[model samples]
Structures are given as structure tokens and as C-alpha cells.
Target: MGPSRLHLAQGALAALALGAAVLLQGQAPAASASSDNLTADRVENLRLGGDGVAQRRHMWTIFADMVSDEEPDFVHWQGESGVFGAEAAKRPSGIQGFQRPKSIGGDPHLIGAPIIAYNLFNPAAFAHIRAQGLYRKATLDRLQLTGGTGSVPPFPAAAIVIKTAWWPVAPEGLTAMPVWDPELNPPDPTGNPYLGWARVVAVDPTNISQGKTAAVQFVGRSFPGARRVQLEAFHHVAVDAAMAKQLAGDPESNRTAIIALGRPIAVNDQLALVGINVMTHEQQDWVWGAFWWHDRPEVGPFAADRPSTLPGPWRNYLMQAAFDAKTPRASDAGAHICFNPWLEARFPDGGQGGGTVSNCLSCHQRASYPAAPFLPVTRGAPNLREDPALAPDRLRTSFLWSLTLHAQRD
Candidate 1:
């Protein structure tokens, strides 16, 4: 959408300034200081040798900024009320400080535990869409019909889109942390032993009412121990007594769990972030990265080059990044997979076998307005040849699925 409308003039001007700022940094050398310092050239020049050691460091800076930025949390940002519901729509301007998500919604596709996912937009991205009125179906439809050439309307270079996964915590879960070492449980060979187990809630799809707790899985890692000084290890949020009142809207439900909000834990309950997918529009194709929390964050190729300043539980994460769909071609022989287990691991069409082989940029490349099926190919290189989604001149969403999934009808 162009700035042809009088109403969007002011926003368009602001976007220009933001665009210049982003382009300036994007064209420059990778910043030595720790911020969102990923340059487009750095992403384009990435190599997969040594398991992408240098590439992982570049991606970690984005993660560091996302978790440690003094800005309001993604859930509290603008337009979340309409997209994720009121629980996520706490206005940022009025907020006193950085607040965590009020409630986390469950994803049925994910097999075990009460898993939650979030689609977040930074200020620059949200402001651009709001200015263009792209959130409305009518506007999107109009643009689809009349909007000029190009695959998609390019977003500001500073624009960021994030998808994060979280797991709710219970008091019993905290106390039940397993200390078993990997040497003892050789059969359970997916992840580390110190990472701890997550309480799995099994649900029958046909009968939502019928459900029960399943066997524990190697998914979560809990907070601190007996020592008073030991703070929580994960980037977590707690629904305290006051916030609980605001959410429930009932005096009696204040101290009780907000089960209706998809949070089974009580009023003061907490949830820890488990996985995240981050993307930036600084480049034309966009820079993509995925992260999953790990107890032994020190090990693995994904954990390479982590900055010392990454801060707190954020350091306890492993990362993988993909700059191009098929640059450093499949040396690992896993189809150049770059996916978060919590966010995409369960989808049957996620990859050739499943999420294990999925690539973020490849899947997101199919994001079009009329809504194309996001099918992931077995291999990372060579995207769908004759994409039915891109045919018939569909309005591309510039690799943002949120625009297709959550755009409102007015």
C-alpha cells in the first residue's frame, strides 16, 4: 500500500525516517556492540561450515534484544487485542513497565504439554500496517485487486516479526524437577537430562472435556532452587493477584486459576518461554532464526558464539539461523533444517517427514493474502516450482503469515 491516502501521510513520513535508519545500519558492517546488529551483507555472506558458527552469533543478537530490550513485551504491543484477544492487548503507552503476557493460548497441533504460541509485531511493522489499514479484509481485498506491481508490499527495514512458544508452570511441576543424568537414561535420547521434564496434558480432539495428564517429557527446565538468591532461570511471567483480577473481571476468581484463559495454573502462576522464531525485514528475503531453551546451553553447534551479554535465562538457549533458502547447501544432510521444536515440530506438512526438516524462510515464502497452504518441502533448496498460491496474482504478505492468519474483516 502506498501513501496515496491523506490520512496515512503522517505515518508515511515517519516510515521514511525509520526506513533510512534501518537501511543505514543494514548496509553498514555488523556492529561490534550488542544490539539488533545483524547486517544484510552478513546474512547474505553466511556460510554453513563449522555448523554456521558465525551465523549463530549474528542471530543471537536479535534474541538478546528481544528478551532484554527495555521496551514493552510483544504481547502488550499494539493490535494484539484484535489478533490474540484482550488478554494480550494491554496498551503499551499506559503500561508502567515491561509486562509479560497475561495469558497463553494452547496449540492443539502440538502433541504434549499445554503449549502456547504468539505472533508478535514490533512497533515499526505494526504502525506501517495500521497506517495502510491493511488489517481490514476490505482494505486487503482492495489492494489485492488494485495495488501495483511487485510480489508484495515491502515493509520497513526495521520491521520485525516474531513467533514464540511457551509452557505454563505449576507448583507441582517446579518441585518435580528430575535430576537424572543422561548416562542413566540412555534410552531417552532426544535431549539433555538436566533440561527437566514437562507435564504433558493429553486431550481427545473429539471430546475436549475428556483429558488427563500424560507421561512427562524432556521439554522444560524450572526456576531456582532453595537458595533465596537463586532467581528464575527462564524468561518467565507470573499472573499475580492484581493482574489476575483484571483478567478474570470477577472478584471471586482473583486468587483462582484462569483456566478459561487457557492458563490452568492459579492466580500467581507462571509460564516459561520454551521456543522462539524471529525474523527481520532488513533484507529483501528477511533474516530468519529459531531458538529453543536448553538446560545445557553450553553444548552443540547451535550454541556456538553466544555473546556474554545475552543476559539471564536467555543465555540458556540454542539457536539456528537461515539467511538464504539454499546457500550453504545441506552439508549436515538434514535438509538445512532451521525450525523450533515447540512451534513447528508437530505439523505433518511441516517438512518432508515433519518439522525436523523444515526451514523458516522456505515456508514463509508462500505467505500470500488470499492464503496459500504453507507446505514445507523435504529439502530447503528449490522452493515449489509452480506455486498455486502465487498464481492468479495473489497479494503477497511479504513473508508474514500473521497478515493472512489474523487480518480482520470489517
Candidate 2:
């Protein structure tokens, strides 16, 4: 959940600013505003059709003094976490604009601690869909079905936490690299929903059971001792060197996963927070309107020798991906649902009890951050994976091509 706490969003969040789409909107009806109201127009006057948007200091501000010193933790984080809810979560006036937009992770300008990059490396096509059989009956219906529930394991946890992360200060005096421009200030350009390139400090999980060492909890209370019982197995290619050039010459998105925890957890870690699962590709039924999606705009910047381009039938273009993509809806029962390591989340007996794994575990389990899956990712950085010219460990292996996606269905 790049913006953090997806399931949240429950009540008064009407109190805005993750830079309310660039400092409280208002302006631009083609352009020019003393106050037509896009949120009072500041983010550098904005301009969509003319092409000048990403304002708020041309985006990637890095940290406008943490939006003027955390302005009361962004005003009690806009009235307690859920970033505004109740009234059935408003925003339907004419599409997009209720409040709470900014926050690409640590709000107000940025200054480290944002974390939302990807590639938790669990390849071999998620170990061949965890040795399927209809994915072992959808992991027994995500460890056992929902709401009125039957199938269980909804997040037990014997250990698998990376907690809070945020580190970005040296792009070597940036000239062109960081970006998260949501747009609205006089700049609608189709109201750029999200286009942040990518940015996560670490975490390369995929040890299914090989276990190389993992015991690194760093909860809240603002990180005190920040305990550290064990170590190793996160490697993340030694903490992201942009994955040695996106895993070079792919080995089916290059293999070697690390860490595998399953045995229930969390009871007194008592910090109503949750995270680190990573797999929410759901908008299905083969293009079910594919949510009218947009911006593929004929892909982009391809050629870098196009990652050598040849491998077993183009290696399914290294297993394609598109989770929710703005509004993409696809159907037939499935289209965008990813997070395949045989879709793990196996916790039936460690801390909380009733195991966990519905993928989205039914509406994000009433989210207080409960296994949060805000997962909107891929807003922009269009290397579009699959083979975005190669890198996310090299692509391919969305479970070794689901039979090349069922051989494109007979």
C-alpha cells in the first residue's frame, strides 16, 4: 500500500492534504483561476492539456520541510488514520475529489521512510502456483473462507515483518529521477491519479521454508531499541542496486527466494498495524470492462536491446502483470489478482489464531491496517514489467505462465 493503510479510510478524513491533490485544489477549467475551486490552486498554477502538471514543486520535492514540520502529523493524520470515511466514504460529485490524496508514503514533501517498491522474489512461477490443484483449492479458500466465514487462516503470523521503512536522500543532487505527481491544481490532465516511478528501501522475501534467518521486527512507538534478534535472507540484491540491472539476462526472472514463516502470530505486539504480505491483483473476469483503463499510450522507451528478447516462446514476456490498473476490470472470474508464491499467508497457529489469506481477505479485514492491501501499484513507471525491458528479477514465472495462460485458452 504505497500510500499506506489501504483498508483504513473510514470517516471524517474530509480534512485534507497529502497536499490535497496539490495544496487544496480549485482552478483550471481549461485554465486560469482566482478560485473556480480545484482546492484553491497552488501547486504551481497547474496545467494539464498544455502538459504542465506534477506541480507541488515539480514533484519529488524530497521534503518541503515535512510540509512545514508535520503540521500536527498532517492534522492528526486527517482525523485518525482511516483518512476519512463515514457518510459512506463520499467523493462522487463528478468523479475524483473527496479528499485524502497526497501521501505517497511519508507525507509533506518527503524526507525518508516511505517504502512501496516491489519484487519480493518468489519465482518458479510462485513455485508453480505452490504446486497447484486449483492452487490447492485456493489455499483452501485463503486458509478458509470469510465474512460469516468457514475456511480460516486469516493471518496468524509466526514471524514475517519488515515494519516501517523510509530512506531516500541521495540521488546525487537529483536532476531527473524521482516522481509522484498526482495532479489537480489547475492540472487535471485527466486528473493524473498516480504515476510515481517506484521507491522502496528493502525487503526481498521468498524463503518458503529454506529459512536463512529472519527476525527483524520494528514496530511503532517511533522505533526505540528497534530490536534485532536474527538476520540475513532479505538480500534484495544487496538492498536494490536496481537489481543488478533488473536481474540481467533473466533466468525466468532469476530464482533464489528466501524466508518462509507460517504458524500464527501477533497478540500483544499490540500495535493495531499490519503489513508485508504483498499480492492483490484482483479486477477479473477477463477484461470485465477492464475498468476502461488508460495510459498504456502504446507502451514506452523499450529498446535496451530489449532484454535479448528471445526465450521459450518469448517466455510469456516474463509473465505479464496489471493489478487494478487505475480502473481495469476484466472478468471470467479473474484478471488482476497477483501475489503468487502459491499465494502464501499461511498462519494457523502462532499469535492470533484463525489463520489468514483471502488474498484481499474480504474487504481488507476491516482494516486498522489489518494486512492492509491498498495495492494500487504500477500507476506509472511503465516498464510495465512482464518485460518492461527487464529488471523485476527478470519477469516470467507468474507461475511459469499458467500454461502460457492456459495456452491462451485452447
Candidate of highest TM-score: 1
lDDT of 2 by residue, 260-326 (tens): 0111111111110011222211111110000000112123311111122122211111111222222
Best by lDDT: 1
Alpha-carbon local distance difference test for all models: 0.53, 0.20
Q: Candidate 1 clashing pairs?
A: none
In candidate 2, which residue ranges exceed 4 Å CA deviation?
Answer: 1-116, 119-138, 141-148, 157-175, 179-242, 245-410
Each prediction's total of clashing residue pairs, residues at least 3 apart in sequence or on different chains, is 0, 64
